[model samples]
Target chain A: MSKDKWNDEEIGHWLKSVPKPEDNRSRDDILARLKADPRLRDKQPSRSRKWIPAGVAAAALLAAGILIPSLMDGGGEVSVSDSASESADDAAQTTSESFQSGRSIEQNSAASDEEMSLRSDQSVMEKGLMGAAVYPEAMEGFVPFRIGLVHEATVVPVTFLIPESVVAEDFGSVSPGDAELYNRYASQIDEEALGFDDYHPYQGTVSTDKGGVTLVLSGDHPYDTASASITTFAESVQETFRNEENVLVRDESGAPAEFDQVGALPEIATEPEGVYFAYEKNDGTTVLAPDRRFDPAHAAEAIELMKSRTTDLFEPLIPAEADLIVELPAEGDRMTIRFEEPFDFSRMDDQDAARMIDGIALTAAQYHLRVRLQNAVNPPAGYQLEDVLPLPAGPNGIILSLPG
Target chain B: MDESVFHRIYEEYHQDVYRFLIYLTKDRMLSEDLLHEVYVRVLKSFGNFQGKSSERTWLFSIARNVAFDHFRRSSVRRKRTDESFDWETEQPADRGLTPEEAAVHGDDMDRLFKVLDDCTEDQRMVLIMRFLQELSIAETAEVLGWTEAKVKTTQHRAVKKARELLEGMDGWGGGGR
Candidate 1:
């Protein structure tokens, strides 16, 4: 045996030091330990509303809304097709003309301010809550928290919720294949508040001299296309509006209403006052109630309060003791529960996965909490835990608010 | 065979399983724990054992996969925890050298581990079974579901790469092998 090599001797010495097996513990004990440790069960992806943009990007591409095709290839950077700029302008003009015609706006060059205001009000009334009327002032408040969006470029409805306060800034022709249009929309929203289950309010569309996209506002999910109305403006206005601060309150009719209220249901704590409450069963998967008027500066503080206050209500029924620290950038927390000295996931089939996902989802739903399926950030298998349901464009997970 | 066949097999071959793990990880306690795990696995799959490789070879192969899986999981956890745990530090040094000299020789092994870790599970399995487990080229081919010629060619490349690493060093073994 060579001294330098890791021959049988070195290995034998190391093996002798390991713990002796008792063979005493029953199978149930091992299973119990595993079940009690969330870390042991390969972590399913955490769900969040952040993925709405990506979903929207996919949806837009699928909807034939924009026909941008992949340009990059195996070679170096793709050269911009010279026809891109001219064709893009042409496409923008066509989309604008169609949208304007659909809304039946007059082609007159000189419309009175009163007429414009009356048309804006009429547009809001036509879509009802399906439209979010964003004014110029209301949009200014939410701009700082805006993150861009990713949506299916094809299916992305060209509609948006404009608080009555927003003023359009500039209306210029778009570069036909600019990928950032969706990205810009996604990045500009408060993702935590407007995730898979919540509405992601957008800043007004980049208007153009071709024909400006109109802002429709009343209080509701921004992706509610049926509620939006289009308009053409010779000059663009910067849209601004206040973010809805109250939870949604419903009238006797049971449709989601736009109003300021004390809270949602009487069972949970009261929804804060002065804020408008809008309750929605986001695409039939998650129920969320977001305040259209949130102040971004207070969001982190608000998140902490909500997390601590609702901890007990949303705790799991099986009561696991694994470390539950939310993952930070580089910190590592791991838990490994043994399975009778022979762990085999190959035996676990789809039925097992469904049962596990269902149990977790049902337990979460009890507290009115919706778990958004986030892909595994890292692990044994990097896989998406759940498919994002195809929704027109809305937040993806359960939305909740704190009591005043 | 009856369940007692598995119990008897475990009693007879548990040490060989432990020894196989020891060669792979070079950590005695970890190897023992893994050895026990292998036997437990064998106990579960005893009925499925079709006698393809001899009982000993089959047990060794299972032990190898388990050890490899453990290392992969450990390294992933370590990486996630410290974003900077260098896996090169875990390699063993070469013999026939003093402590300081061995450290220098250890660099080759470090690069070897890095290359091995980066390989796909299928490729890595073939490499380890041949060199580290000291399996014959044919034995490695059988265990990994590969042809004998493929195993030989891959092992030759693996050895050449290891020699290349050694050649890059000062006072190295050169490429005589």
Candidate 2:
């Protein structure tokens, strides 16, 4: 459109002229597809009926746990334990009653839906715990202490949740080796007390710095080799110190290791839940590992951090060399990713490309956002997404099999 | 929605949805597939449709999602040995002349689309919605889930970029005017 300066009116006129191909298919084709969609079928009654009892059963099981504590404490008002047990019992009773009444069909259906949603949430959490070999014997009374992985410049923290029994008052008074030993024992209890499946003693040195803690790991294996345990310990030590600015994980030489190193002291703060990292295992299966500190709110920023390839466990699907530029929608549920020159995907084999896309998609999916690749080269067969790119469903579809 | 209601919606909006997908994908075959997927989603989720947005806006939003899903799924599929695959290859020859060629053949509309391909996806989306779809800034923002300011800024930038691209083309002299 010709104008002194191009305007919206002219642009609109020009755009309207773009050829819109004819749709030869009749309305019958669409009606046929709609009919074929099983989701539109009349299966709600059966599905809703199945979940009602399941919800009741779950609530009863929870009530059973509550009953145990009250029964153990016995009947005495003066006993603090007895009062705590009574309150737990009351809460459980309320929950059970709520599940029992299905006054209206709509209300019943809604309750059933809530139960199904809760079950799905539990499954996701269990999947998130896939790689972790939890030592329930040691962790019985321990509460999760979350430590933020603060990126110094932006003060954006990725929090890691660690289980701990007691918080240490002083790290300065103890030797580095002693502090490590004390923290490990305090968190996991005495080695002799631990069951066979409990995690082993620390194989790393811990030292305190100015408002920060430094971990000098001695093991030959990378941090990711025992990612769940190593990260759990790192989080615990950070939690123990009150003035921790950052937690630094280091090699023996005292220099920052390329992967999962450079721990500063703690600046312990909690963010809203739903923090996750996309990490690939040795077996090549990529899994979404949830962290209390990995905030999804800073997903755009977190995605940029992933590009640095900082963690041993997590790798960026988009190659490190690629110049990634992202545009996040104002609502924050969708993102547009553009890669500049040297971001070639044409040379990658099908598996590598799929892995790359999976990493990007899984990370974005954690935040409930879909990603569109703006300038991706060599998209897979049957896909031509130079424009209007959409993310596929995340690989969370694969059922996570926990390590035996 | 019931089949009869869905049939009415299909009759009312299918052409617009199909056209939008065609513009976004530049592949008629793929756009056709996405059009069906969009309706399938619409059919499944119709009960949840609160009428908070216009039917047209909702349909376009669904179309956009369907197209993106197509890109994602296609990217993950095992590679085929299509030696003919080339990133720079012009729009399929069977699809008829590209906008640039159409512009040379005295089609002003094609010329605009040719210039549009040079803009970023966000810019292009804003331009298409605001101009060709003739959606108001508020409507465009609503459909895109972007702020009105974002829509305005993106529209401004898109026009500037398209002007630059057009200026560079041979025999360009405000053909639309």
Candidate 3:
């Protein structure tokens, strides 16, 4: 009864007195309603239907990568008497040649420059090929054409290829005007390359305005590639549509993205390049190597990859047993690395600590990121980094350095 | 969910769900409508019930979301109307209470509901789940997607506010019934 404070017992007693309505509906009425209720039907199966288009788009893109090169080579016109099997063989041959040229350039570049080269030999291979004017006439307006380097591997080079026929009907479904544009672009493409091919390059709609050519990369094209690949793809697209003063690239969501040229793209690093993992040299000095499989663009992902015990090829400098929690700032490019428990460096010598710092700093630097160590006791001399410490130029500073 | 299993669940928890919705919305017809919707959603998502929480807590959580959705829809409707609507002034269904029955129980019960309606939605939910439904702090937290500490804090605040509201009532100054 006290007004100042009411306990749970008093509150319960008062709430128990609140009146409620009696259920007047018959069991039959409830059952009937339940049977008719649409939500009660199996809806989970329908949820997966949304992903079908994406799967189709991915398949179409893969097919385009194989078929587009040959189609472009033949000038987009196929002979009516040519068997489907023969056309398939030609496409397979073109794909092989393109891949071979890419590999040869990569091998030549690696041999020429011992340092890791930012620009792969794919650019040289592209230069050898005819310009974007080689885009077949069948694909001009009907298909979305994007020419860029694809980053499928650390050292391997692949060209960006689009398969536009997969979603041409979807574009044409939008309006008659879009159909007209598709025809105009289709006619404008280099039709002499391949005859009326089933697959055309370009996945989304392409339109040119007073500003420049805008290519909306629609459906499932290029989103699965690395950040570097997306940038390369955009650059290639810009190169192909070079006459336009500006080339605006939009993702499937219709949001304008500059990849990494002017702004950051959404974390599209399905496979990013230049991931660093710690390895030890013969002299017991720890070194870092760019791990191709595990490219971590952020500090937390990098720390997780680091925590995975290394194989014989690489060694971990940070104590494998130490649980590190990393917090990345939302607005700025700073990362804070905190240990689950206070990290004791008294057991570690200064050189070992310095090696760990180098490994951490170089891993962050791969993403153009920075790190701040929290609750690190006895960090190495001149390396007690507090907040927002700039990453070292390279990892394993004593034994190895990054290429300038 | 299998039809037989779904029927059994509906039979077991429908009343409790109906009561909770009534407490939340105060309108019996709206509560009944939302109760049906809650069960419909439960049937659709029953396979995803990972058994991390008790069936009762999960059902109450669904009920809470359905009630909030109703509130959102009604608020949008209310925006179009010229006249203002006051929750305190809206009378709940009498359920055929006689003049004599009303005279005996209506005043204090009405006042209690009015005070409850005055509380913030989060505070009201915490108080109702913790006290009226006799859910534990952990259960309340799970249902509301909140921390146990947050549940305790909101419960404390809600009780304090209810006491203040009761004390302000005419001729009801710190005295038991």
Candidate 4:
């Protein structure tokens, strides 16, 4: 047997030489395995069912053949994908991709035919995510949050939905400090207020650079009209936000001490509604007001000043109106704002813009709606929100940047 | 091609796969379990395979990975490492000489196998796949993702080492040829 680069004759001989099993009993045994494991028959196109017969063919060859052929039973070099099963175990330790690569099924010594069959009968969903699923009903009683980053390290206000009958004491597991603060401010919360069902306090983080405050509502009512009462309450809160004074919830420690006031805009208007003052200083920036008693006139003035600013800096860089549209095709839950024009964000520094962008994002959380701000064209130079986000450009926008 | 085709494939390949596992892991039960697991996986992913390499080379590669993976997942490994043998627990040697292992037949072959065990896994694999498995140079190279030069060089070293081991054996390959 000369071996000179394995000619056609050698390959054919090699192919024909592999051993075939001597009995039909083994074939019957494997078929019984297939019958037992219904997963093999569950889907025909999948590799599981597809290769069973191929395996049987290889088995048949060995059972019937006289020669040992190659000590290895593999017919040829299997491609990576074909060999995926062999490496499935290794895949877990190697590349993340191969965990699902069940190309080869090793025979089991401890596995009973019954166990194999039962596994195949089980649905994939039954297996669950990493073996466990988060219960949906539990989510109902808990506050739903999509907590994420706000500017460098600050977190957006965490909104809480307080049930009408609940008092600060009913809040189980709430930190003692929070309990103390709630107790100190108990008088402000009207337990019997009619619109208390949807009462929520807009809670934001507080620190030297960033601090948090909560906009709370107080009231108490019976269990009878909870659902409808809650819905109406939510609407009333929104209406109050739009038409009343600019709410301010001040942290006990006050704003960050290091702010360098470049200039002070007059003391916030007496009847400020939508307008909230935010100051930037050397240490970091802080929002002037969070949730406070509503003032419609002051809000109108602040919103007017904010709307008049320009954003031409990074026009092309900003996501276009077509792209920025959230929950496309007219899904109703949205924070609708009519912009004067499309904003050009190109002018503002990227980092500052990201910061300013957080303001709009924070606003969105409060409203529980997706907000987008469009920028105006031919905007004034240096008329950008400093240390925050760039002005947005588009029709019907919600600007996140500070008033220029 | 058909059910019969698969039946033939399994019967033919199962033992070879088992043998490969046995040799690689040196654990009979682990090798059997992995052999079945490899076949099951092969059945599942067979359709995705494109005919780039021969099925045999592909199968061995699979067996190799399965064995390695089993090695990783087994908690038994920690026990093996922890349970060190005490030198005092040895049986007294028998006075008489024992016959050569019937499996190897020749003393030289037995020495060669011992030397094969002493070789690095990579060297052992190259030699086994080449001489024992009788894979072509190109085939072995493809299976291990090694260049042909590396496989040949390693094979040379392995055989040389085996010869060195053989020289110390009693028969010594018929009195050193």
Best candidate (score: DockQ): 2
Give the candidates in order of DockQ, highest first.
Answer: 2, 3, 1, 4
Q: What TM-score did chain B of candidate 2 earn?
A: 0.77
Task: RMSD for all candidates, in order, please.
Answer: 24.7, 22.0, 19.0, 30.5
Worst 10 residues of 2 chain A by lDDT: A150-159
CAPRI grade of model 2: incorrect
Regions more than 4 Å wrong, model 2 = A1-9, A44-404, B72-113, B171-177
Top of the candidates by TM-score: 2
Determine which window of 10 residues in candidate 3 chain A has minimal summed lDDT.
A123-132
DockQ per model, Cα = 0.02, 0.16, 0.14, 0.01
For model 2 the local lDDT of residue A364 reads 65
| lDDT tens digits by residue: candidate 3, B1-177 | 367766777688877787687676665555666776676667756776799999999889888876764453344234334445333343223233335224323555566566776787778887789776779999999999889999989988888887767657633555545
lDDT of 4 by residue, B116-135 (tens): 55667777787667765678
Q: Which regions of candidate 4 fall more than 4 Å away from where they truly are?
A: A1-27, A30-404, B1-5, B79-81, B84-113, B171-177
Tens-place lDDT per residue, model 1, A1-404, is 11223333443332233332223334444334323322123223433443322212111110012111111011121122123234333423433443344321112112222221211111111001111111121122111211122211001111232212221221134332111233344434332222121123433332222222223233432222211111001000111111222212233344433222111221111112111111222121111122211222222222222222111112121113222222111222211122222323234432222222332232232222233333322211111234321111221111111010
Interface RMSD of 4: 20.4
lDDT-based ranking, best first? 3, 2, 4, 1
1 versus 2: better DockQ goes to: 2
DockQ of 4: 0.01
TM-score for each predicted model, relative to the true structure: 0.28, 0.40, 0.39, 0.32
lDDT of 2 at B32: 67
- Range of the 10 consecutive residues with the lowest summed lDDT in candidate 1 chain A: A227-236
